[model samples]
Target: MTTSVRGDQLARLLGRWHALPGRRRSPDYAALAAAVRGLLTDGRLALGVRLPAERELAEALAISRTTVSAAYRALRETGHLTSRRGAGSWTTLPHGHRVASSGLWAPDDDLDMIDLGVAASAAPVELVHAARAAADDLPRYLGSSGYHPIGLPELRAAVADGYTARGVPTSAEQILITSGTQQALDLVLRLSVPAGAPVLVETPTYPNALAALAARRARISTHGLDIDHGWDGEMLLGALRQTRPRMAYLIPEFHNPTGHLMPAELRERLVATAHSTGTELIVDEAFVDLPLDDPAMPPPVAVFDRHSRVTSIGGMSKPYWGGLRIGWVRASAPLVQRLAAIRVGVDMASPVLEQLVAVHLLRQSADIVAARRAQLRFRRDALVEALRDQLPEWRFRIPGGGVTLWAELDGPISSALSRAAEDVGVRLAPGPRFGLDGTLERFVRLPFTLAADDLTEAVRRLASVRHDLDHAARPTWRTPTVIA
Candidate 1:
């Protein structure tokens, strides 16, 4: 079934479409077409979704129907859109331009290139050993159907035991295993939010999480964070009290892009405020296990909530291995039951063998994470050093735990730089890829997930790309995008 995008919804997604810095103003029609193209290329607006009517979109954007008509006409000529007489216009890509790669997907053709697009590390050797051991345990379940609606019992207990050890007092009944945290979030969004419902999220969060919210067609409300500064209490409190969002998705443990860990006091306050607003917090703890600074890990976010208003979502993907594709949600048993029922209509269950492997790996989690942290610390340091040495003008804070560095460029050239870096065989995630709207142009996310040598080389290429962009840039009003 084709998803339909409404006029007002398309207007919000095409925010400030005509206000691109450093480029001369084009006709409104041309500018509108370009913004739609960017959304398609970034996978924010998935192809094949039917768009709004020209008159409806024009009214929503407060533009002339002629301009919207011209825009849609141009889009069709370029094969970015297709329309039938009765059927509305749907997003479609031209033949050659259709092969888009996202943060989760590496282009199959770009095997030799460096990918700083994804913040995932290579699987630890321990995972391989766990896989071998899991094979031995798999035969025990082969006699039965492999379909586990919620998850395998052994894995659920292991994950629940993990939370119980961490002070959350979780039971196996509260755990519902998923294919990954992405799927976990999808399930939570399904249960917790309805279309056009207010849902709060950070300004520059995990891109995939934003996409998930978009998929649910949630009315996204934003709270911002700075890389140098952490969360803004006043802004967050105001958002909660004003929007009174139905749900809020957060990454308090080790925020993606920016590695700011929300303080324990703040987490407590936020949880209380969310409860007051009747907001359910979907806490993403994907990077909670990788602590580079060796700081004491904070208790689970759910521990701070007295009302049981928090649902903690996590996976083995970030800390252990993405290939495992095993994750779970910790919530009230009734909610877990609801999630399992909802999940049954989807993929049904994660792969039995991968779940078995995750069970073994979780048992040995301490040693695996210890080794993983050592490698991350080394690579993070190397990436930081290379950036300082090669591009001193670039500003960033060394992230204590997460795998990425959110760097601020001297200008709003992040989108331009990402494209130019392709010539150097390095793929970079531009800052706006993490933004809710067309923002964060002065920043970029660099992952230290590569080896130390590759990290150094990637920065070297980035420095070259920055140097080239700096020379080619034109004089313009470079308005800084403020977080919060």
Candidate 2:
């Protein structure tokens, strides 16, 4: 099946190819279909993108074409891939859930599934014991019908204390507790966003935030984070000045996906930039507590702004157990009030028992931080070592702290790699999942928070897949005909 590769067509797809990372140590044929479907859902690979012919990819990957063919056939049956007799194969947007949905098993259904998609770690032992003890005290709050929207006084004070400990002064009244960091994000979005206004966001950012803002009809304009050197301070300030956006969302400390920390100087400049443009800044600090090492991070962006343009969002999901269902917003007193008022329509109130448990956990947060920091550091180092050994072709900077590695695949193999990974029981978040228009296709985020054993296996399976692709034979028709 040799198709001529036109010079222009090859150039068009050249820089657009990306390789998704593998999360399984070994391949499983039965599980491959569902995993590939997830890649489609997660926006790692999109519809109509051409896949490398089986033999071409297999020879390039040093793997058997039979394996590649099986994976492609599996995807074709699921409507994730389309093959024409002579035009070759291309990725497709799944048409319906009947195929992919039926293929997906609940996480509980697959006892072997390892979730590298979530950034959370196992719950801290001390917090668990403390939560148990706090449950014993839950009935005391039952007298009030348990509707505590502002959160219990103890929890708010604990949160306030956390801010003070980090050099930011705050009062309990300035805090509004919510269901989780996600709820905090939603509350702030409702209170601050004016429909149709532009919001400044970083490229390769948290996807749900983008969706929430879009749902509110807020137009988003993104500034790219330099994957090679981290966030470009000059570029960010320039974007703020040019757009003068209504609001800008940031994850300054231990940023997600890229793990780039904007320097304290940049943080101050960013806040200043926002103020100069009359733009409000919303900072998500969910991953701030998961650094590989406790490097001295700058004060929260909120602390540097004398004009009060910054709103801080925090959550228990990343730092502690995600099951806590507790998160809060710290803003100016007026903003806090506004958020609280808007929150009532979403849910009358958050669960009081969870707040109580979070308060108990808060008391021991320092200990929990110490334990989590150490454990994550180990996983980070382990993953880094594995990548260095098995996939030396890829390049990445060692992130100071964070759960995932933002890696440049060094070649356009992300989509094909993702498909190949699915042939084994692995899943991934393609680089474009964090960017718009699939701009970061060559980049992939690999979480380092999985168990050491699982991390090793995932890397091994990934290496195997890569080996297969490297050795597959080339096909005559390599250039796919773009469907008009």
Q: Which candidate tops lDDT?
A: 1
Clashing pairs in model 1, backbone N/Cα/C closer than 3 A:
none
Q: How does each model score on lDDT?
A: 0.83, 0.73
Candidate with the greatest TM-score versus the true structure: 1
Q: How far is candidate 2 from the true structure (C-alpha RMSD, Å)?
A: 9.0
How many residue pairs in model 2 have overlapping backbones? Answer: 36
Candidate 2 residue lDDT tens string, 1-484: 3233332333233332222233233343323444445445544444456767677765554557786688678777766778898778876655542324323323333455444555667788887687687889898887787777777888899998888888889999989999988889999889889899889999888766876787789988998887777788899899999999999988887778888887888888988888899999999988877766668877788778798899999888877887788889988888888888888788978887788888888888778887888888888888888889899999988888867778898665565565556556566656656765556767777887778878877888888887775543211111111100
- lDDT of model 1 at position 105: 29
Per-model TM against the reference: 0.84, 0.79
| Candidate 1 lDDT (Cα, 0 to 1) | 0.83
